[model samples]
Target: MQIHAHYNGAKPDPYLINHHLEDNRLSPESALKIIATSEPGGEAVGLPEFVFLNPQADPAPDKPLQYMIKELFVKETFRSAGTGRALMNWVIAHAQAAGCARMDWHVKPTNEAGIRFCRSFGADAVAGRVSFRLMLR
Candidate 1:
């Protein structure tokens, strides 16, 4: 997975996934949760498809808390099946309902499809913004 590959060449932390599942992060005030289900039984299909977001702390008091989309992805086969839109819609709706001033996410410039998808939702790319990270290891 891209996340696995990005973590300093180390595997993803299982504990983190467990913590996400166990926490209140999916509550209405936090982030919306979307789960793919099986056809017949309607059980969770699981894996390779999910969106994770959280309330972002905005420094500006005039702005309500913002929601940050931390991770979003759909299974390759389900890419165009409206799954991504559904997940995004859920997040947007909940964010608005939670009194968030805005929603934000980071997308790679080379991810043309992702850029288009975000644009389709009326998202604008902010100018002069860059992300930096320091590896503690």
Candidate 2:
């Protein structure tokens, strides 16, 4: 919820969150949710969510899977404390172990900090492409 609020600048609907969680539970391997904490059983300071994608035609023939990061959030207090980097490193390693050909994600054009963080990992944005969405509800 905190991560969602941070990005959206508003609280998310609890009903929607619960519904999303239940759906993920039904197909756990489709998504991965990771929380970072200072100690075992401690409060969360960061969260990263990624999904495994299997397309009809694999983008990389040698690797059958791909990873798409849905969200990556580190609390403001923990932003410069290596929390985000740690989360990203873990995700990258996990994707590699799962035979993912590539990993990609998006950052809002105005999110300079997010852009810098992604660039630090050598991530580049796809050129000549635009994102579009349709809200069914």
Candidate 3:
């Protein structure tokens, strides 16, 4: 919720968030969600969500499956404590183990800290692309 507020300027409804998580849990092959804690059964201090795109669904038959990181959030208190880096490294390792072709994600243009962290991982921004959204609600 804090991450959503930070990126979207609003705190999303708890019910909606729960519904989304439940749906993801029901479809494990399509998405992966991780919660990080400081110790055994501790409170969650970080989360990372990933979506898998099956190569068979794409028109390009030769393409391999890809992983898309939908969100990576570490509580403000945990920022710069290596939590984010650890989560990213774990995700990358998981992807590699699954033989994923690549991993991709988007960062808000004004999120300088997020941008720096991503760049530190050797992520490059693609040019000539514009993000658009259509709200149905």
Candidate 4:
């Protein structure tokens, strides 16, 4: 199966993520919003089938209204096999193509999969990673 930019990605199958995340009400919706927008405003890489990446350019360039990301999730679907890796590889290649200095994200302290996933893309922590986010909405 070819990877298409699917919004809402196959309804958060029980096998994919922990059950609690799906029922968290806002998290799934937020995930939906990210998928729907295609260019999830805050994603380090704006939503698009493909986006231009530059390591030299600061990904989180402050825009008055435009959202940016520090800890972006490089999503992939397991069923499609290597699709997730494909997406991430593309992103990494894009970054190199655009001459990005580097890419990084902080995985959860306890998220072994997340850590593993990021490492698969050859990601490393340049500074303090594995922190917390206190979203007050």
Candidate 5:
């Protein structure tokens, strides 16, 4: 079994990722387009987002640093194969190597799997929720 991390834009599995995330308009292109169109910085989006996946390679960093996990999803078929754990492991190693004192994750409370998996990574909820009302049309 082999594991790799890569940008969706450059991978052969873009098709797979697109297919898996398509139902809810979760394609990487659309996501990037959204980012590109953001007003210089950006506003908050409540939707679950994945910034990267199993990257096979790493960027050349002169110092210790962990790559940020922009978005995450558990592929239905790979749930039992430790894919999620592998991803977290990559994060841990990256952070440790990057000189970060600790790593963090933000998962919705309703995401039981995400919650459980994060706990498995020794992630404790240091803070609770912050809520507000939106006057959407």
Candidate 6:
């Protein structure tokens, strides 16, 4: 139920959230995109979802901006309910409106379902990049 708790606003660890919020508030090129889904009668159907976006400008000003999807998630129970597709479509619309050339996000190689889902949107894995992370305490 950690996903449920997280989307319900129980910020067990506030450091990252605070940092991202601050960054969003301070930068025009950066933002936090949060989408909350609920029932028609105003009931919570599942946890809210969110994605972090950063619009990077191309070297050539004539080109459109590039939007990076820093993170994306939907509750496991809510998968295949059209929520993920709807959310991704919304992101795509927003990116287009913002004049973004493309919207990009990475997926773990082990997540075959994720890869398939992304591919459904015409997203292909970039051939030359490796994802790396370094956690600092």
Ranking by TM-score: 2, 3, 6, 1, 5, 4
- What lDDT would each prediction earn against the true structure? 0.65, 0.82, 0.79, 0.44, 0.48, 0.66
TM-score of each: 0.64, 0.81, 0.78, 0.41, 0.46, 0.67
Q: By lDDT, who's the top model here?
A: 2
Expressed as tens digits, the lDDT of each residue in 16-88 for candidate 2 is: 8878777774355645655455636687788777778986655777898989888888888888889989999
Question: Candidate 5, overall lDDT?
Answer: 0.48
Write down the worst ten-residue block by lDDT for model 5: 31-40
Error of 2 at 110 (Å): 0.4
lDDT digits (tens) for residues 1-137 of candidate 5: 01113223244465665575575445545532112111235522112232332233443344333334555544445565665566566656656665654444466678797788888777787565554569999
Candidate 2: C-alpha RMSD to true structure equals 2.7
Q: Can you tell me which runs of candidate 1 are displaced by over 4 Å?
A: 1-63
Clashing pairs in 3: none
Could you tell me how far off, in angstroms, the CA of residue 17 lies in candidate 2 after the best superposition?
4.3
lDDT of 1 by residue, 40-89 (tens): 66633222223433334445455556676766766556677777787788
lDDT of 6 by residue, 1-137 (tens): 34536447564566765675568733556454555566587644443233434444334355457767755666666779987887788778877777666667778898899899999999999888898999997
Name the regions of candidate 5 deviating beyond 4 angstroms: 1-68, 128-137
Q: Clashes in model 4: which pairs?
A: 38-47, 39-47, 54-100, 55-99, 55-100, 55-101, 56-99, 56-100, 56-101
What are the per-residue Cα lDDT tens digits for candidate 3 across 1-137? 78778778999998988887677654666456565556366868888887778755543444477888888888888889999999999888888887787888888898898899999998888688677889999
Residue 88's lDDT in candidate 2 = 92
**Total backbone clashes of model 2?**
0
Q: Tell me the lDDT of model 6 at 93.
A: 84
Model 2: pairs clashing at backbone N, Cα or C within 3 Å: none
Estimate the lDDT of model 2: 0.82
